[model samples]
Target: MALFLLAFGVWSWLLWPTFLRNILGDEQSWSNGSPTAFLWVHVVIAVVSLVLGTVIGVLGWRAHRANRRS
Candidate 1:
């Protein structure tokens, strides 16, 4: 599960810029909206993934500790 979340986070991190461009509009061609606005959405996704990854790591650590204690 941690590995999956880590993979997802990495995937999103890799794609975030591309996704932002798609949302805002292509840089090399005609663009219609504020790139900054779409950038915030990208920021949100990044922040959420960071938070989720941290949570997953913490949970995994706790589980490991519990297992070791028993």
Candidate 2:
């Protein structure tokens, strides 16, 4: 479970930029309303992803330790 979460977190981080661009209209080359608005959304997502990734990585490490002790 931890390993899976870690992998997913890494994947999310890697794709985050593209996701941000898409939300910001970089992918479609068109804006929904304002670039600033979309940029904020992107920033929020990035922050969430970072937190999630960190948590998952920590979980994976802990799982490894537990396995070693068992």
Candidate 3:
């Protein structure tokens, strides 16, 4: 969806570099330690967006079906 694409673009611009650097540096490797800030940021964004998008999609689908039946 348009919203998802916009969100992804913004997220990539803000966090993609940090994520790549963290992984390449091995900062998140289990042997080195727990995950880094980059992973956490991505996780939070992903979870929140997924949940919100699901809700919105369901609502929109229901509305569309209702309109068609009327």
Candidate 4:
């Protein structure tokens, strides 16, 4: 589980920036010089996911270390 969480967190870190870049460049992401709902929603989701992933990864790492010590 800890390893899974760590992998997930790393995946999120690697994925979100590229996804955000794609979203920013996508035509559907903009409308009349403003960002569309699609862009906003995706950005929010990505940000939240990144934060959660980092937290979960840290917890997982701590758990892994604790287990090693026990």
Backbone collisions counted per model: 0, 0, 0, 0
Write down the worst ten-residue block by lDDT for model 2: 26-35
Residue 27 lDDT in candidate 1: 53
lDDT-superior candidate, 3 or 4: 4
Q: Of the candidates numbered 3 and 4, which has the greater TM-score value?
A: 4
- Global lDDT for candidate 4? 0.89
Per-model TM-score on C-alpha atoms: 0.50, 0.61, 0.54, 0.89
lDDT on C-alpha atoms for all candidate structures: 0.58, 0.71, 0.58, 0.89
What is the RMSD, in Å, between candidate 4 and the native fold over all Cα? 1.0
Which should have the higher lDDT, number 1 or number 2?
2
What is candidate 1's CA lDDT for residue 30? 32
Error of 2 at 42 (Å): 1.3
Instruction: List the candidates ranked by TM-score, beginning with the highest.
Output: 4, 2, 3, 1
Model 2 stretches with alpha carbons more than 4 Å out = 17-35
Give the winner by lDDT: 2 or 3. Answer: 2
- Which ranges of candidate 3 are over 4 A from the true structure? 1-33
lDDT of 1: 0.58
| Candidate 4 lDDT, 20-66, residue by residue in tens | 89999999999999999999999999899899989988888888888
- lDDT, ranked from best to worst: 4, 2, 1, 3
20: Cα error in model 2, Å: 4.1
How far in Å is the alpha carbon of 57 misplaced in model 1?
0.8
Distance from true location, Cα of 20 in model 1, Å: 11
Estimate, for each residue in 1-70, the C-alpha lDDT of model 3 and write its tens digit. 5445445555545654565455556655334567667666666765565666556656655666666789
Residue 11 deviation, candidate 3, in Å? 15
